[model samples]
Target: MKNILQEVFETLRDFLSVNSPEQSHMLTVYANLDQANPLNRKERPAWLIELKNTFDNLSEEQKNALMTFDGASLTWNGIEEQIISTLEQHEAKGRSVVVFTDLSDTVVIDLPLPVKTGVYYGIPQVKHMLSQLHRYGQYLVVLFSEREHRTVFVDVPTLVSEGTLQSSLGEGIFLRPGGNKTRTQASERRNLDTERRMLREAAGEINDYFMDEPLFDRIVFGGNLKIAHGVKNNLHHAVAEQLVSIEPIPFDATDEQLRETVSILADEYEAVHDLALIQELILRGETCGRAASGMDEVMDALQNGQVRKLYLPYPMDADDFDTLLIEAVLENVEVELVHGIAAETLREMGGVGAALYYVIR
Candidate 1:
């Protein structure tokens, strides 16, 4: 039996395409193949063989028509030459050429004469990369005479501020934007300051209703960028050192981008929720250890269903851990395994940590 790694190398070397200019850009042949090997040689035989065979069995027509090149080593000069030559030869022969490559390192391509050039890659390197491709009436391709092909850029500002507001009803609270509104005169300053205070107060009132013990899993502030920022800040202050996260709801963010962001936040929340529950459990154990007279108090709390969530440290003595876990299950308490708390702490402590809860009530 041939070694799977060697088989894959041979397969790629054989079936790989490098016939067209576009396909040349796709090839990203690596010299240090060991780095790309994701699995142990012994355990990965089946996978290696399957992968090797999949590429090895390509149709002859596909193989012959395909073009391949190495992104890892192909120089900029080589890229230009290959693309230009391929275009000239194919165009003169009365055939259009298209390229394909799995690995993308080729930056751009310029066609000769009347031929058109288009780059298809994961994403472009333009600064302030848009979350989604914009849909407009017609695609514009404005050319500049600058020989250097200067990159275009856009400005994006990050929001960072802190302050608090309270509602007249007492339970509601809000946080307004921090820092001066602008470097203008007294009238403008007064107006901005007053607006900030008002926004904070409104946010405070909304948050007040949420501060009751055993509040809901999360309180999300979405809509109106400025107002959302204020709400996030106020909630952070009100929650203090607990946990919270501020997610900016972009006016232009698409459904897909929003969905991806939500998914990421959910994963983060689960992690934080687990860590906080575990930290509390550790604290309970420490408190029990330090107590002069009564471990019975801690036991009583556990027995009476006072523990809302339980955090079990990783790599515990299996037998003891199972026993405790079973007992907690019987009591209907939630359990989690703590990994790292830093990121979760940041999230939940603000809205980041806010996604998870410890209530401590």
Candidate 2:
């Protein structure tokens, strides 16, 4: 099955493909369904109420445009009813839902990860959607052991297992009964060689799997630290470069345990990743290199198509955050929604930054 990240990418592609004219009216609702009280099913969701208020506040022109977009088939009320009914039926209690409609085609998506919730009643606002997707990118976990090794692909935010690429035992190397010290030493040497050979084979299999399916943003190794490191050493440079961490999980860990371990590791890795990016931005900015910090500089860089990547804090409160995000996405700049200490640091630095393709003199 395709992971949530893959599904989001496909959805984004499809959404962008739909023809949307300048005069077309679009309703984009990003609601945090996870905040709904499951116990109080009778109460209207906060998001629905917010949407109602937003709709009420729209100008007559906007309302008329939306109501008449379907040409007598669907009205504004009908569209609202559909949204309510669809959301009511779906089991999206702990997730965010995005509703995009040009009044002709309506697409609803349930996001496995949480996002900054709001109702955008203009052109489809895909910045938050794309940012969330980037934050919870796809990853691979390789759990190595002496007897067997397993490879599992996971969606980082949801901890949902996409699929297992490999799960097989290696050649067994048993200790031999040696009569003399010389024979015992020889047997030990043979066992070591066999182990190395098994590790090399495992690394080759992993490299091949990555080559065939290269959607993984990060790769982690867990279980049997010795074997994990051994396999890491033998991995091809392309695969090795993506390795984030070698965790100390047991070889016989249950699926739940494995997921939990990887989840924590992924978060830590992301925190470190965010910090490194922020540091890079700061260092480059200091030296007048290819980096821009603060809203104005970042926006200028994005407009110039000089931005290679944009970094913003999660739960951005800045009024221009979405505008910056939209510009970055339109420019095909990589977006990273930072959290934790890095996010705090970014907020201090005007809550937005970008790594540019080149320094602007």
Candidate 3:
């Protein structure tokens, strides 16, 4: 999924770079490919019907411009036939299919996630498509124990473990005689020191691991709480700041159990994060701070490149929302498709808001 998103980003970049005067006639189509009935294989899919209807609805001038644009050889009928042929050749398994063409060059992308189904003529409506393709940041789950410690890298959106690092702390052996009380106390202290040393080393290993691939957005610690906290304190400041939660998972938990624990904690963290963002936006808007709520102010902030983060409700149907999203992406602003309470609050604020870098005033 990450690789697929990277490809989509690259495609978007290429599309944005085109400078031809005839580029205005480019047609981009987004279609939901999920079939409603598996048994009725011969039935025409609903999305295909919608696509045909969209073509039929376009003005004659618009239709002619698309078909007869310079460098474009395919007519409207030829374009539809090619779309059908290409779709037929591929298995109808993905959630959506996106077609981008200047009528000369066509790029079809079969996405794992669903996107808004429609025809976007004149300009490529890519904001919604990119938003759907966006994957949340990765997670680093570290399970610490007295005897063994493990670090599991997780893809937060899918809750799938990418890989793991593990190390065994050697047995706590007392070198001195334990028969005497003083010697026994000293032995216990030495064992504690050994455990702390092992944990510190494990923390160092984690730092090194992420230094090579620093993609994880959040960190979760599990197993022994005391040990986890100790390791957390030992981590680098940058990595330590990413520590979101510490869960009560057993050191010997199965893969499934670990994944479930991480998922639950991650979801909780996200909910809190979303709520906080919404609250900040509300407060800033009321106080006239570096925040903009509602479409007008947010769009103005986005145009000036002052928006640091743009928040929008998922699955918004309005064309204006699409335009705002496109502007946000083109400016390299962080776009978050909020949901639940955050989305509801945003909808009340005209379905969009932004955290700005600075207020123009």
Candidate 4:
């Protein structure tokens, strides 16, 4: 099941990155047309009916371009069934209909956004799950210990264990108590130094782990607070800055334990992240004046390709900004769907904001 979801995620990602130039009507119908509970699958959904009506009402040109002239080759009935069945397989909460002229490559993505659909001339606005994907695969967790250092990569839609690194600080009976008290004390001091060195070495190992790989957006140290801090101090400043939280776990944590820890931390990190970005948007809008806000300003920024990150309040009546949202996405802008306090923040900023790639002055 996890593998299936992963595969879906990969497919969605590929579609999101695609910037196809082939023109003509590429029908996009995003609708929530299924019951959440299987038992409630009573009758055809209103959205499906509405979707069919939508197609039926399309201008002759749009209809012909979408399903072909006279509509014999690909009927709406068959396409609707295909969309529903595909979405159901992925436990999709919402429907995304991307039926291109190239029917063989047509697909329905099971992204769980509230149904708000639109169609544009060029590439369908590919959001690429900017926030969700960013949240996932961005954690680098290390469980530090004097004996060994264990690490795992916990990410979205899936949790992954990255394995471990055992310490070689003082191998075999280095702390055996014997001989004179002074000698014992001196050896004890040496052992303590060795322990610190081992931790430092662990930090270096962690740093090296990310040198060739993409740097994690968040780093979590999973061990004793003091020891985690000690190891943290040795981390490269760039990596150090990405640190999220310190959590205590066993030196050799089970995969389940690591997964649980990662899940909890990931949730907490996203919460803080949403709040921080919202506050920053509000703050910047008020003071620095960099946040391009309001429907008009945001739309203009998007069209001018100035928006680097776009913040839109979730559960919004997105009909007004849907086209602009797609334009921003196709322009490679990062789009975030913020809710709760963040949603209220957007209300003050005219319901949208953008971090500009460059001021449009």
Predicted model with the maximum TM-score: 3
After TM-score superposition, the amount by which residue 209's alpha carbon in candidate 2 deviates from its true location, in angstroms, is 2.7
lDDT preference between candidates 2 and 3, better one: 3
Clash totals for all models, in order?
A: 37, 0, 0, 0
TM-score of each: 0.30, 0.72, 0.73, 0.63
lDDT of 2 by residue, 30-148 (tens): 76677555632537766667657766777777666666654655677886787667666767744688877765567778875666656556556766676565644567887765566
Off by over 4 Å in 4: 1-24, 28-65, 68-136, 160-162, 165-181, 184-189, 252-257, 314-321, 337-339, 357-361
Q: How do these models rank on lDDT, best leading?
A: 3, 2, 4, 1
Task: Please tell me which model should have the higher lDDT, number 1 or number 2.
Answer: 2
Give the per-residue lDDT of model 1 (tens digit) for 276-359: 654554454465532111223333445555555444333232233333333344454444334355333322332111111222
- Model 2: CA > 4 A from native: 1-25, 30-75, 78-97, 104-119, 131-139, 151-154, 160-189, 317-319
Q: Please, what is the whole-model Cα lDDT of each candidate in the order they appear?
A: 0.34, 0.71, 0.71, 0.60
TM-score of 4: 0.63
Candidate 1 displacement at residue 257 in angstroms: 2.6
User: After aligning candidate 1 to the native by TM-score, how far in Å is the CA of 116 from where it should be?
Assistant: 55
**Predictions: Cα RMSD each:** 22.7, 5.7, 5.7, 7.8
Error of 2 at 226 (Å): 2.5
- Candidate 1: where are CA atoms >4 Å away? 1-186, 208-215, 220-227, 236-243, 276-309, 312-361
lDDT of 4 by residue, 178-289 (tens): 4666676677877778767766776777777765456355688876566788878888998788788887777677878877877777667666777799888767767767
TM-score of 3: 0.73
- Residue 221 of model 4 has an lDDT of 86
